[model samples]
Target chain A: MEPVSEVSGRAIPFGRKNIDTDIIIPAHWLKTISREGLGRGAFQALREDPANIFDQEEFKGAPILIAGDNFGCGSSREHAAWALLDMGIKAVIAPSFSDIFSGNAFKNGILTVVLPQEQVDRLLEVARTDPINIDLTTQTVTTPFQDRFAFEIDPFRKHCLLNGLDEVGLTLSRDEAIAGYETMQAAQMPWFAKGTGLAA
Target chain B: MASRPRTLYEKIWDAHVVEDRDDGTSILYIDRHLVHEVTSPQAFEALRLSGRKVRRPELTLAVPDHNLPTTPRLDSAGHRLPIADPESAQQLAALERNAPEFGIRYISATDAQQGIVHVVGPEQAFSLPGATIVCGDSHTACHGGIGALAFGIGTSEVEHVLATQTLLLKQSKTMEIVVDGDLTPGVTPKDLILHIIGVIGTAGGTGHVIEYRGKVFEEMSIEGRLTVCNMSIEGGARAGLIAPDEKTFAYLKGRPYAPKGSDWDEALAWWKTLHSDKGATFDKSVRINAADIQPTVTWGTSPEDVVPIGGVVPAPESFSDPSKQDAARASLDYMGLEPGQKLAEVEVQNIFIGSCTNSRIEDLRAAAAVLKGRKKANNVKWAIVVPGSGLVKRQAEEEGLDKIFIEAGLEWREPGCSACLGMNPDKVPAGERCVSTSNRNFVGRQGPGSRTHLVSPAMAAAAAVTGHLTDVRELME
Candidate 1:
C-alpha cells in the first residue's frame, strides 16, 4: 500500500444515500480467486444504466468521490474498499461511513473524509463540473472554485495513512511490548492459548 | 483494586486491552478469529504476496456457508455437491484450499460441522464467554449472546488477525436496552428485535455496543438471545450482548472446544462474574415493555421499515423528516406497496425460513408447531426451510421436524445461507414477494427486484400456510 498525503483530481459526484457494499461490489464478483481487476466490478449495478455517472466519460478515473450519508452501509466485505481503490478513487468525501468500510478503506490507503452533510452536498455540487483537492497534511478538502472545507480525523488513523503503516507495521513498531505481554500471558494462562501456542 | 461496578461490555473489553496507546485507539488481543469463503481470499492472497504465514493458525476457524448450495447433488449416498454456479463453486474451493494451506481449521460443505459461521462458532463452543471474537461477517455479533466480545470485521482485519491475533480499535460507546414484563404467548425474540429496530430506526445504534438487559432477556433461552443479538447489525450496532448466566454455562458445558474438568470450573467462576454490576452506567439506555411487542414484519426495504402484523404501513408523507419520507417512498416503490395497506393483506409468493438470524432448533420447532398438520396455500409456489448447520438439520430430522415441513408442502433444505442473499439457486424470482426469517431486508437482497418481508419463523410458516403475511397469534389457540 502507498502512503496517502494528498489526492487531487476530478471527483465523481455519486452522492446516492445508503450505497451499501452490495452495491459497491456485488456478491457475485466476490467469488474470484484474485483481487486484481476488481475495478470493472465496482458499481456494476449502477453502471448498467446508460445514463449512470460512473460510466460517464468526464468522471473516468476520478481520484475523489462525494457520497451520501451512511455510505458503505452494509456487509463487512473488504472487497468494497478494494473496488474503490482499484477504480483509482483515493478519497471519499461522505457525511458518514459504515465503521467496517471506513476501517477497510484506511487499511488500503483510501482516505475516508467525513464532513457535515451541508459540506458534503457542496462538494457533490462542485464535483459535477470542477476538480476537488484533499490535503491530509491540513485535513482540508478544496475545490477549484476556492471553496475550502476542513475536517477532523483520528490522529492514529491519520498517522497510519500518512506513514503507509499497515497492521503488520503497527504491531512490528511495538514488538518488544508485544513480546513481553506474550511471555506473561503464556505463563499465567497455559490453557488459554489452547492450540494457538505456536506464537503470540 | 478499587471497587468499581462495570458493565459486562466494560469488563470483557477492559480485560482484553493489551495496551492503551493514549491515542483514540487501543491494541487488544483477539481470542478467536472466524473467516468465511467470500471475504478472506484477498487477505490470504495478501499474505502470500507479503510472505507472512499465519502467526496462530489454531486460533482461526474457517467455514463455507455463504454461496454454498443447499441442495447438493446426490449419488447413491451422501451429497455429491455438483455446485451449479461456477462462482459459488470457486469460493468454496478457495476456502477449502486456503484453510488447509494456511494450517487453519476448515469445515467444508460436506463436513457435518459445517454451517453458518455464527451458528457453528457457539455450537462447537469455539466462541467462549469473556473472549474477543472477530469474523469477516457482519452477523458475528451473534456470539455476544454467550457473553463474548464479538463483532464483524473486514477482510483486511481478518488478515491482520491471521498475522497477529489482535486488533487495534477505538472502543465503542456502550448502550443498554432493558425489556421487562412477559412476552405475548406467540411473540418471540425475532419479534422483539424487529420491534426494537422499528422504534430505533436503522441507524439508531450506530457507534455503540449494546447490552440487552432486564427480565425479558434473562428468561429467554440461549437460542432466543442469539436471535436477538444476531440482528443487532440491522440496527447499525457494532455488537450486542447478554450477560452470561447459568444458561450460558450450561450450553457450553461439554462442547468440543470448551475447557474441561478443573479448567471448566475456573472458567465458570470467571464467567459467573461477567455480568454487569448493580449500577453500571452506560452512554445510552432504553427501556421497553415486552408485552407491547407483537409479531413484527418489515414493510419496506430496510430493517427499520417495520410494523406489527396488525398495523398498517404508514404513509411516507406522514413522516416529518424529509429524508425519512424519501427513503420510505423509495422503499414503497421498490416493494410494490402503498401506504395504509394492512401488513397482513400483503401477499407473498415465497416463504423462506433460514439464515444465521433464526435457524436454530427452537426456530425449527416454532415454525413446525405452526405447520404440523397444515398445508401451504396453493398460490404460494415455493417454500423452503434451510437449517443453519448440518448438525441442526440432522437433529431436526431425528425429531421429525423435516417430516413436518415436508408434509406441510415446504421443501426441507440442507444447511447453508440458502435464499438469504440469493448467492445460491434458492432465490425468489424477480418482482416476487417473499416472507423470510432472515436478518436483512435490503432491496434486491433476495434477488434482483425481489421484495422481502422480514418475519419470525412462526410468522413465515403461517404465511406459507395462508399465502400471505398472517399473524401466528390468529392461528394460535
Candidate 2:
C-alpha cells in the first residue's frame, strides 16, 4: 500500500450510490481463477456504453474515481478492488463505502477517501474540469478551485498504508506480544500446547 | 461506570479482547477460520514471503467454490478449463498448494461436500452457536442463523484469523425485527426476507446486527432460516441472527462435522443456552405483519425497490426525495417499464431458480413442485436451476428433482454461484429480463442490460411457465 502523499489525476465520476461488486466485476469473470486479464472484464457492462467513463479518452488512465454514497456494496469480491487497481485507480473518493470493500481496497494499496456528501458533490463538479489532489500526509483532498476537505482513517490502516503492511506485517508488528501470550496461555491452558487441534 | 450484566455480544467481545487501543477499538480473537479459493492466495503468498508458519492450523478450513465452473469443459488450447476460468483455476491451485502446507482441510471441486462455504459450513455444523466465524465470503453471515456472531472478512482479516484466531471489530448494536403470524400458503422464506428488506429499506438496518424473531421465523425450517439470514447484507445489516432452538439442534445433529456421541450431549447443553433473555434490551425494534407480506418482487435497481406481485411500479414523482425520484425514474426507464405498470405484467425472457440464497434442497423441491408437468413458456429464452451445493445436487437428483427440471424444459446444472452473477456459462443476455431467485437485482447484476426481478424459487418456476412476472399463489390455488 502506497502512502499517497498527494495525487493529481483526472477523475472518472459515477453518480450512483450502492454501486455493488457485481457491477464492478461480474460473477462470470469470477470463473477465471487467475487475476490476470481481469481488468478486461472490469465494468464489463459499463464499458458497453459508448460514453462510459472507462472507454472515454479523457478519463482513460485516470487515477481517481468519484463515486456516490455507499459505493462498493454487495459481495466481498476482492476482484472488484483488483479490477479498479488494474484500471489505475489510485484513489476512490466517495461519501461512504461498504466496510468490506473499503478494507479490501485498503489492503490492495488503494486509498478509499471518505468525504461528506457536500465535499463529494463539490469534488465531483471540479473533477469534470481539472485534476484533483489527495494528500495522505495532511489527510486533505484539494482541488484547484480551493475546495479542500479533511477525512479520518483508522490509525492502524493509516500505519499499514504508510508502511505498505499487509496482514503479515500487522501480525509481525505484535510478534512479541503474541509470543508472550502463547507462553502464558501454555501454562494456564496446557491443552492449548497439546498440538492435537481439539476444539476449545 | 454503571454496572450492567454482559450480553452475548459483550461476553464474546470481552472474551476475545487481545489488544485495546486508546481509540475505543479492541482486537478480538478469531475463533474459527473459514477460507475459500478467491481470497487465500495472496495471504498464503504473504506468509511464504515472511517465513511464518500457519498458526493454529487446526481451526482453519478451506474450500473452493467461487471460481469453480458448473459446466465441465475444455479450453481452446486443450488444457481443459479445470474450473471454468484460468483465474479460478489459479485460485483453486493456490489453495490446494497452501492447504497441505498449512495443515488445513481442503475440499476441492471434486469433493462430494464441495459447495458454497456458507452452505457447506452449516451443513457440516462447523459453525456452532455462540462461536465467532469468519470467512472470505460475505455470505458468511449465513452462519449467524446458528446464533453465531459470523460476518465476512477481507483477505487481511483472513490472514488475521489464520495467524491469531482473532479480528478487530467495533461491536454492532442489536435490533429485533419481529414478524408475527404464520406465513400464508405459497409464501416461502424468501418472500419473508424480501418483505423485510422492502419494509426496512436497504439502509434501515445499517450498522446493526438484526435478530430475526417472530412466529414466522420460529416456524421456518433450518434451511429456511439460513435463507433469511443469508441476505442480511442486502438489507444493509452487518449480520442477521436467530437464537438456537430445538430446530437448530436437530439440524446440527448427525452432520459430518458436528460433535459425535458423548460430545454431542455436552455440545447440546451449551447450545441450548444460546438465546437472548426474556428481558434482553435491543437498540431498536421493528414489528412486521407476516400476513401483510405478499409474494414480493424487486422491480427497481436495489433490493429494497420491491412491491407485491400484483402491485404496480411506483411513479418517480411519488418519491419526495429528488435523488430517489431520479433513481426510480432511471430504473424504470432502464427496465423498460412505465410508471404504474403492473409488476406482474412485466415479461421475463429468462427464469433462474438457483443461487446461494435459494438453491438448497427445499428450494429445489419447491420449484419442482411448481414446474411439475409444466413446460416453460415458448418465448422464455432460458430457464435453468443450479443447486446450491453438490450435496443438494445429489439429494435433488435422488428425489428426481433434476428430471422434473429437465422434463419442464429447464436445464438442470451442477452447483455453484451460476446465474446469480452472470458468472459461469449461465447468464441472461443483454437487453433480456429474468425472474431470479437470487438476492440482488442491481442493474446488470444478472447480465449486461439484463433486468432482474427477485422472487422465490416457486415464483421463478411460475414465471418460467408464464414468461412474465407472475405470482405462484395463483398456480397453487
TM-score of each: 0.96, 0.90
| lDDT values, one for every candidate | 0.87, 0.79
Which candidate leads in lDDT? Answer: 1
- What is the docking quality class of candidate 1? acceptable
Candidate 1, position B477, lDDT: 68
TM-score of 1: 0.96
Q: Provide fnat values for all models in the order shown.
A: 0.43, 0.35
Per-candidate DockQ values are 0.48, 0.35
Candidate 2 docking classification: acceptable
Best by TM-score: 1
- The TM-score that candidate 2 achieves is 0.90
In angstroms, how far off is B351's CA in candidate 2? 2.0
Residues A2-64 of candidate 1 have per-residue lDDT tens digits of 888999999999887777787788776777767677899898867877999987899999999
Q: Write the per-residue lDDT of candidate 1 for residues B95-186, one digit (tens) a residue.
A: 88999999998887888899999999999888889889999988999999999988999888888888877888999989998999999898
